[model samples]
Target chain A: MTTAATTHHSAVLEHRDRFRPRQAAGKGHVSVRNVDIVFDTHHGPHTAVQGAQLEIQPGEFVCLLGPSGCGKSTLMNVVAGFVKPRHGELLVDGQPVAGPGPDRGMVFQQHSLFPWKTVKDNVAFGPLMAGVGPREAESVSRTFLSLVGLSGYADAYPSTLSGGMQQRVGIARALANYPSVLLMDEPFGALDAQTRTMMQENLLEIWSEFRNTVLFVTHDIDEAIFLSDRIVVMSASPGRIIADIRVKLERPRQAELLTSPAFMALKRECLALIREQTLHAFEQQNRKH
Target chain B: MSVKPGPFQASSAVVPSSTGERGVIQADGAATETVVGTDAVGAAVEASHARLPANWRRYLVRIAALVVAVMIWHLAAVNDLNLYLRFENVPNPVVVGTEFIAQLSSQTFYLHILHSMERIAIAYGLAVVIGIALGVMMGRSRFAEDIILPYIEILRPIPAVAWIPLAILMMPTEQASIVFITFLGALFPIVLNTVHGVEQTPKVLVRAARSLGASNAAILRHVVLPGALPSIVAGLAIGMGVAWFSLLAGEIISGQYGIGYFTWSAYTLVEYPKIIIGMLVIGGLGSLCTLLVRKGCAPLLRWQKEAGRS
Candidate 1:
């Protein structure tokens, strides 16, 4: 196991030097200012996110941690420019986000892959859409597929792959465009616990090499602590940010760190915050009923 | 315990060595043998041994059923069986077979078959183009759907046969009239299915495409078109069948040289054997056209079959 890890580490380093010259600094800064999102349901206008504010530095890894219906995904979608915020605005790299563009890549939970395309073609889609020539697009796809350890299955269709493999392909497809920011909405949420752990590690390794800003959304406390540099916890019932907890754990984290006392402490803090918010949400629902 | 590296080692290695070892152990336990056991080898041999005879038996049963049906038809016609329904005027299978052979040697039979095929080709091609265009417009824009969909709904349920008299009066020639009827028959299914396919395209895919920097036209081209293909292909197949149904109606009423005209003229001339032969030829041609549609679209849908396998 140690030898394999060392070999993979060296390979990642070697590829980092060759294919991914470190991204220029100050490229992927994300600022969400007083954002509010609302949906008009049959009953009335429902507020999804309320006065949310966040700032992620270039090359930072941040996770939006919350329970279901807390609007964490909605907030991420706002950043991805898929949803229009009813009130405030979002800016990426100092530019206002008018709509979804190639500058920000997104990974959904599962089944977001173009099932009609081959794994290679799915990865190549972004570059091709950017008007890159077919040959260059093909090479770019090959590079990213190898980065995700999926070079062998490039010819296979998305549906033929396991969930973990599909998510890996989704990551490759997103990164192939060389987006300034990568937004992942529960990318590993559908995988088994074991697969999810491995995916998290792989994602961190890729992020370290690319050093692109990533805004990850998840409900798992351990996952947020394990992957992100900062964990932004949100509350349900008019979803809003409640806590912006910075993780002080050291870099190049391993699976073994998951058992470390420092990790557990962060987990404890997040758990308490989430429990309080969940109870508050429950009480609000009860009062409405 | 020793761990054997699987063929998928490069990809599975991403799972971390600990889980990979667990996977090996699970595989060994499932085989209920030593780590290097011949259990998988034995299963392969047994499965191959079992499959051939089962497939052979299935084919034999199908052929037997078809042969029995033909034999019953032959017997009934020969005996002049009439119990509330008459087989007395019906031609025997042997006589029909002889007449079919005779028709196959004649140039007029070929001409009739060609006329029917040509009408279907022109009509179905027009339907595919117009239906998809209208469907995409309706699907992508609410204003287009509201304007166009009402007229489609009102016109769709009327059968192709009902259009024959009006089509003949409106068209300049018999061929044009027959083609118009066939086009009407095919148009609705293609339009309806294309609309359903476009509307059914997953919203997530559209979002994914947009985030990947695709423009509106690019999204429609890459995401919407491919996503709606299976449904469109289904519509094409249905439209082909309906085109044949309506083509025959139009051809029988007004066509100078077509399979439907040949069949009806045979009936009027009391050429019973030729009529049976004409019916068989029409059935064969229809099946052939449908088979062509499916075969032509198979390559586009190969991913669907691969996905279904797992």
Candidate 2:
């Protein structure tokens, strides 16, 4: 029985390998060049991000960490091609981003899994949209579902699963596309602390395997510190990159590492950086009011 | 996990039911049924609650209420208690019941029913197709909405019954005129509801699909359609109810043979009992048709059931 399970697991992995993009191709090299994003609000034109310049190396796990209402998500969306920059250029590898495409996969804060579809179908949607055959898409879904440890829930509806499970499926769906860049917009922000931590670990494990360049947007300092190779701190509202701190921690990170001195040091650094900016933003709001 | 299997241990080997709601919530990816929050009496109550299908129970209650209403009507008519209502002229339950049973044996009665069903099926089906197509077009494109919305708004306000004169004049055949009236009745609700549903589809889901490589057409087919479905279903339900009303109105006014015509004819002949029988038949058939529609659409709406269950 164990051998059968192992064989099946390996078979799925093999199938995944066959479908997986060329190793070099899968690792996204994103370059955001002095990008500015403006939104025409009911009040007036509001700058969401201003002069946001950042470059992510291939296979790097980067987090855009900032306070609420910060344009971290907006900047990430620019990379995802959901939001076009008003000025300056955003490129993936050397190609300029025109709009959202197959090369970049996104996981939203709200597990936007198509409720009409079953778990496997939702995961297979990317492949099917990319014009893969139904049979092959189904198999790709199976492999990714297994990858996210949700192999048994292939037939279940998204609404049936708990929030954490739904998010896991969301991750699996994103990964199934074999995207060069995985863009996450506060993906685990809605989950409870325990689930959030577990998801973080699960995400790292998956990232370690796939090594797709992940651009995670979040307000949580601890999460950024834990999951990212580099934490890019941005100032609140009309967000600008303030600090870039590389995580010096070892890989294969465990739950116990949260208490480790190295982890605490990084967390403290990020917390202080965020705190100063948050206070500044608060005072600015007060002045405006 | 120490379980020494003995005959005296657990009265029943506890089945690990997720309940998908309460219990010591399992923090696993799989919705594993953890054996927590066990209480024999509580479990029995919950099991009973779960076992008794809500839909069946709801229908049973409706049937009971209907029966009670009929019994009261019977009592009032039989006793000639015109205290509030004119019960003296009304047919009693016994007379109506006997007529109803007799009508069931008559081929003419079946023909009336079959005719009514066929008319409703065609009209309602046409309404659904046209309404959905128009609604989707309006919802997706601002230009379409601007161009077509004024005409829809103008026509939608005018009652389906009011359309009968124009419909009869416009259409050559009586059947076509009746069907047109019924079609008009069902169209507006379906179209409006579909529009609302389409417009309400979350932008996030569309963006997510787009990021996943779905083309604009694919997004519309998969995301917009399903997202708008609950509202569309609500519209369809309302559209169906209106269709029945319009069918009956059209039939009463101009139909050669239908359940509505049967009731109208009975009234003309002053056969009070046959009128009541016809009314009851119409009510029963209408309820049954609506129930069938809801049942047919149930599988499409399984995702919503999970929320209600939990």
Candidate 3:
């Protein structure tokens, strides 16, 4: 089922590759080498990401594309410095990742907006955390919210927002940090297909304006192929980068690009890699059970 | 941001609940998956909603029934039921109502009510102050929760009335004993509710405060305290109810002056009308005080149940 889905994804992406718009963010790069993540579970410490290495150049969009249980998110966390690898290092801006910091802002699959806080306040959280006064935070937050097309939702609470709108606020909050590196883990994986596509386009548009290095994680090959300047296909369980597909696409890419051949070609290749990895991971789990 | 919490929210268990260890995820502070309305979850929720009693009809019926009952009693008493074997001392409903009104004018009766209310007020106030402090402390700290909780649980089952004899013996005077009895009644519910409220304060709110650079004290003040307000008010309501009941019982058992004492004194003289009037006064005061407490707490607890659906 997954293989067929991946194939379909690749076909669509190949169609969009005709118009894969590239943005210039060649100045900021993220480097990860043999990043190994082992989490302690009830049975034992399980290795999630293993020997995953990738070089995401500055101002370029790179997607860590893989199926669920492929450790795509763990790798993103490793890059963001939110997770420390048991072996090897993940670097941002030529420095080894240590702990979560302001330089790399993360937007998770779930919108982590504070429920009691207004949209403006949620967007301003990072600035406030960084000791910016309310006046300064509000000013910066408004700009980001406006960028996310949420200028009118400043005083509204997140509960009032549609899923798509909340995701926009999440993106705004992450962007408001003014981070050089943006790390997103399945950020749009929860959205409906239509909304997800809209967000993908919105993401690229935002990246075009801000022009920062982004390490986006997703299970969707089409999404990776469409949005990423370079796509890193990861294997399941002990995740490793199997393929680094460079999307030869143009800048300011639109929805119409999903019909192009080049995009489909990359998507097909990544889909094949992800299906094999996911099936194998499932087998490994079944065997252990 | 739609942070207005749902009405009747029973976030009974924190997220990742299957794991026994206290791993709290404050959904209140974080955005949860606008959970896809999977058929299974939706069906279960619908079932629960359907099972909920539509009690408005029952409530109206109960009010009607109570009115009918009162009318029956007034009619029974007014229509010569007191004439047969019942002594003239058993004043009819009209005479009893007159006596109640007359008693309200008498300075002696007013003093009796004043003494009873003053004792209950002092004890209930003390219970509120001390119970909340201890409860909040226990709720916040794991060590305190462990140390103080067992003792509270052990003492809670014992009736407040059971402490009357001990209170009378320990206190130097009857008034002090009465106050102590009220304290016994009010203390447990207040402390338990406060602890539960504090304990249940969303960890996410606390984390949100932490992320915003709020200090520990600030987190407690801005998040935990406000988060616990509704539950604390609920506790106050329960504790106040208990205090008034205990006050009446204490006055009846051992008192020189008070409504309880006056009622029993009237009973000995076969003045059933006076006894009934005393009961009426006690019931009226209990309800009025409860209303006052509710009024006082409502504004402070304006954040109560708003969001309904998950």
Top candidate when judged by lDDT against the true structure:
1
- Clash pairs (backbone) in predicted model 2: none
- Lowest-sum lDDT 10-residue window in model 1 chain B: B17-26
Please write out the lDDT profile of model 3 over residues A126-233, one tens digit for every residue.
677666678877877776776676777788766656666777888888777666778787888877787777788877866765678888888787888888888887
RMSD of each: 10.0, 9.2, 11.3
- State TM-scores per candidate: 0.87, 0.85, 0.70
The DockQ-based CAPRI class assigned to model 1 is acceptable
Ranking by DockQ: 1, 2, 3
Q: How high is each candidate's interface RMSD, in Å? A: 8.4, 10.1, 12.6
Candidate 1 per-residue lDDT, tens place, A175-215, comes to: 88778799999999988887788888888877765688999
Arranged by lDDT with the best first, the candidates are 1, 2, 3
TM-score of 3: 0.70
**lDDT (10s digit) by residue, model 1, range B59-121:** 788889999988998999999999887999998889998888888899999999999999999
